[model samples]
Target: MNPCDTMLADDEAVIRALLNEVPFNGWTRTALRRALAACNRDPDDAAFLFPGGAADMIETWACLADRDMEAAALAADLAAYRTPARVRAIISLRFEQNRPHRDAIRRAIAVLALPQNAKRAATITARTVDSIWHAAGDRSADFAWYTKRALLGGVYTSTLLFWLRDTSDTDEDTIAFLDRRLNNVATIGKTRKAITDKRPKLRIPMPGFMRTWAERA
Candidate 1:
């Protein structure tokens, strides 16, 4: 029998009572917050308090959120500190990239023609990114970025469920749609150029017609 099952064999099995159960009553959050506070208050305690890999991951995120980049970078260098939660610590700091980062992106696109491909791409990407950032604006300490990062796990989970329920090749439908749109756009451009090149000019009256009429009179 599984360890959990053996423990649950008797109603009085206190050990098996709550193992592996998801804590929905805020107890988990409270414990996590208290642990984090203790570690923050005493650096010496971190070696003892955060003995596990999970603790290392949690503290790594804390360092980044606190903007102690050097410490954050150090923690990130450690294998145990790497986790999806870490990606989120940076994303949550998404208040806007600092000027240096933004300047770098701007410079990369500066050589492109303004109001054209690169300009249009930059504008659309910013609008899309803003909508994602707003998804976390109401939370303190950018909890939105945390929740958004968590939502990535949901994407794969949801896609699996969709594939199971879908009766047709959804991938094929998507491909065909893209193919048709591309063909229509290509044909329109070709047709437009042809028509423009063949368009005729208006005729002007001949001065010879007036001179001939005067000679006849």
Candidate 2:
């Protein structure tokens, strides 16, 4: 077994234990210590495993969720659906994957919403939206790449907040809300293309920062 793979497995084990305690203790070091104990990991390893403390733990968990969502998308044969439908399905799948950890997610949002964690929050959101687009089979290497992720980021964020408060059975309300938002985006895209069709074509170069991000993606 590779050292990196061993480390990831250890991280996942501790984090999975951490989730069980997050609802009761929030994302504090105390909860993490307990999680370390539960996983039979040395309590002192907390610092070594998550040097950024709660933020690192949350980010790792989000990364795990992204991988799970990608696996779910592939298993679902997302290629059979249209792009919009594929996006919707992927989002829905994410909600389902995190359904059991809803409270932990709420706590995570609160932590990420803090003024100090703004950059981490944005990074996590960007990664998640990018993952969703990739899972939906988007291979665009142009300006639309950024636009699509930005658009889905908004939809995913809004739906996530709505989902945290949703009481409808099986997230029926959240799914409907997501569908409406996706439809609105589609409508706007169509209108913009129609208007652009009548104007002179312009090539917009991808920004340096976005290009860097794309390369990392």
Candidate 3:
């Protein structure tokens, strides 16, 4: 691999390793530096690797999760399912993959939700939904592309937050919540389409003299 790719991979590894300490250290730069030091790497490298500190770590964590989700999607046999089913499967796989590290994930989410990190959070969320769509075989390049991603981003973010707080066995409650959110998105899309279809077409108006003549006749 090229130097840039290799460096990025190394940085990602370091950040991921730091996550094991997040639940205790609170997802701060100090904890990341401590993690780097524990690995016998220069603790100062934390600044160079993640300039935004905890916020950067949070974004990178989501990216790693996205990559894991894509890999799982690629390995699975999803040919039998339709588009929506494929999407649901990808999300389910993503959640399952992160279940082991939910505490760290929750900490990251809290960091991302901070006011200073809002932009990074939105960007990361957008990237995640886009990646999920790509994994689900969505290749649309039209106006619907933006709308589809917007709708899915909302659903994914809400479902993720819900899942983070869920306590049901095997995450059954979170899965049900996800289904409901997806259905809501589908319902909104259908309603918008129906409204568009039923809208009355505009007509050219005739002159007042012609209208009076026709009425008199």
TM-score of each: 0.19, 0.88, 0.84
What is the model-wide C-alpha lDDT for candidate 1?
0.33
Off by over 4 Å in 1: 1-122, 125-170, 200-217
Instruction: Give the clashing pairs for model 1.
Output: none
Once all C-alphas are superposed, what RMSD does model 1 give against the true structure?
A: 25.5
Local error of candidate 3 at residue 178 (angstroms):
0.9
Which is the leading candidate under lDDT? 2
- Give the lDDT ranking, best first: 2, 3, 1
Show the lowest summed lDDT stretch of 10 residues, model 3.
1-10
RMSD of each: 25.5, 3.9, 9.7
Whole-model alpha-carbon lDDT for candidate 2: 0.86
- Model 3, 1-217: lDDT tens per residue? 1222233766667766787888888788788888788777899887776666677677777777788899999999787899999999999999888887889988887878789888878888888899899999989875567668889998998999999988875778888999999999999999967765665553446458646654554
lDDT of 2 by residue, 1-217 (tens): 2222234777788888999999999998888989999998788776666777788888888888888899999999978799999999999999988888899999999999999999999999998998899999999976567777788899999999999999886888999999999998998889867755765556546469867877865
Supply candidate 1's per-residue lDDT for 58: 26
> In angstroms, how far off is 211's CA in candidate 1?
40
TM-score for predicted model 3 compared with the true structure: 0.84
- Model 3 lDDT vs. the true structure? 0.80
lDDT of each: 0.33, 0.86, 0.80
